[model samples]
Target: MTFANVGTLGTKPGKRDEVVAILTRRNPQLESAGCLLYEVGTNDDEPDTVFVAELWTSAEAHQASLSLDTVREAIAEAMPLLSGQMGGDRFTVAGSPLRG
Candidate 1:
């Protein structure tokens, strides 16, 4: 089944843009695997938050991404810019209008 991951990456008071930049730069690497859709977003009301939405071919694919060299490198580079805790949810894809 397809897997969906959605989360917020919190940064320091003024580090959201920097974090987004890093994630943006690493977008291709993140999507180079079984990823179907990968999106990064931020809220103006929540300047310290960066949101990521990912769709993988399967849960295994998502799990395997953790071991990917590019992902590891992205994490290492983005760690210092992180201030608050990282949190996310994983879901099984049922249906979605965008998928059509």
Candidate 2:
């Protein structure tokens, strides 16, 4: 089943851009690992928040991605810029009009 992860990360004040950059950086490894889509967004009304939407081939693929060295490094780099607050949702996709 297609796996989806949609979440928000609370960054330190004035650090949302930095966190977004980290999340959006090019990483071909993600595609190789079964990532279908990975997007990062931000809300002007919530300057400290960074939003992420990810689609993966399977839940296991997403979980395995966490152990990737590049992913781990990016997380480490972004950690200091975060406020330690985070929220999000994960689920198996039921259906999507955009999919065939």
Candidate 3:
């Protein structure tokens, strides 16, 4: 089944753009690792928050990408800009019978 992750980042004031830039720079590695869809954007109601939506071919592929040194480094760098704990959830896609 396809895997999807939705993450919320609570960035410090004035650091949203910088955080997004850093994330954007690191996105290529994820895309190369079977990320079918990757999107990052700020919350409309909360400008200081950033949201990431990612879809991967499988959970294993997503886990492998997380194990990369570059990914770890990027996450470490982003930690300081955060105002609160970063959290996310993973989901498995279920196809609709009507769409098949």
Candidate 4:
């Protein structure tokens, strides 16, 4: 099944722009590493909060990408900007029993 991940990033005040820039700059490399869909945006009312949605072909693919040097570097770069915590969840796509 396809895998999906939704993450919420809580950043320090005035750090949203920097956080977004970091993620945006890494988008191409992430996409090339089997990230089918990737999105990053700020919460309307919570200016310091950023939300990211990602989709990959499979859970294994996602995990493999995480181990890539580029991804590891990006995570290290982003860690300091976070204020509260980063929350994320993984899910598997669902399909009708009869369809399969």
Top-lDDT structure, candidate number: 2
Q: If candidate 1 were superposed on the true structure by all CA atoms, what would the RMSD be?
A: 1.7
Q: Model 4 clash tally? A: 0
**Count of backbone collisions within predicted model 3:** 0
TM-score of each: 0.88, 0.97, 0.82, 0.84
- Please write out the lDDT profile of model 1 over residues 1-100, one tens digit for every residue: 7899999998988989988887877456556679988888999999989999989999998899899887888889889999867899999999889756
What is the lDDT, from 0 to 100, of the residue 70 in candidate 1? 79
Off by over 4 Å in 4: 95-100
lDDT of 1: 0.87
| lDDT tens digits by residue: candidate 4, 4-98 | 99999999988988889888784566777788888999877989888999889888889999888877887899889989777988899785475
Looking at candidate 4, the ten consecutive residues that score lowest on lDDT are 91-100
Which of 1 and 4 is the better model by TM-score?
1
Residue 58's lDDT within candidate 1 is 93
RMSD after CA superposition, every candidate: 1.7, 0.6, 2.5, 3.2
lDDT of 2 by residue, 1-100 (tens): 8999999999999999999888889999999999999999988999999999999999999999999999999999999999999899999999999877
Better of 1 and 2 by lDDT: 2
- lDDT tens digits, residue span 16-64, model 3: 8888987888457777888888789986688888889988999999999
lDDT of each: 0.87, 0.95, 0.86, 0.85
Q: Is candidate 1 or candidate 4 better by lDDT?
A: 1
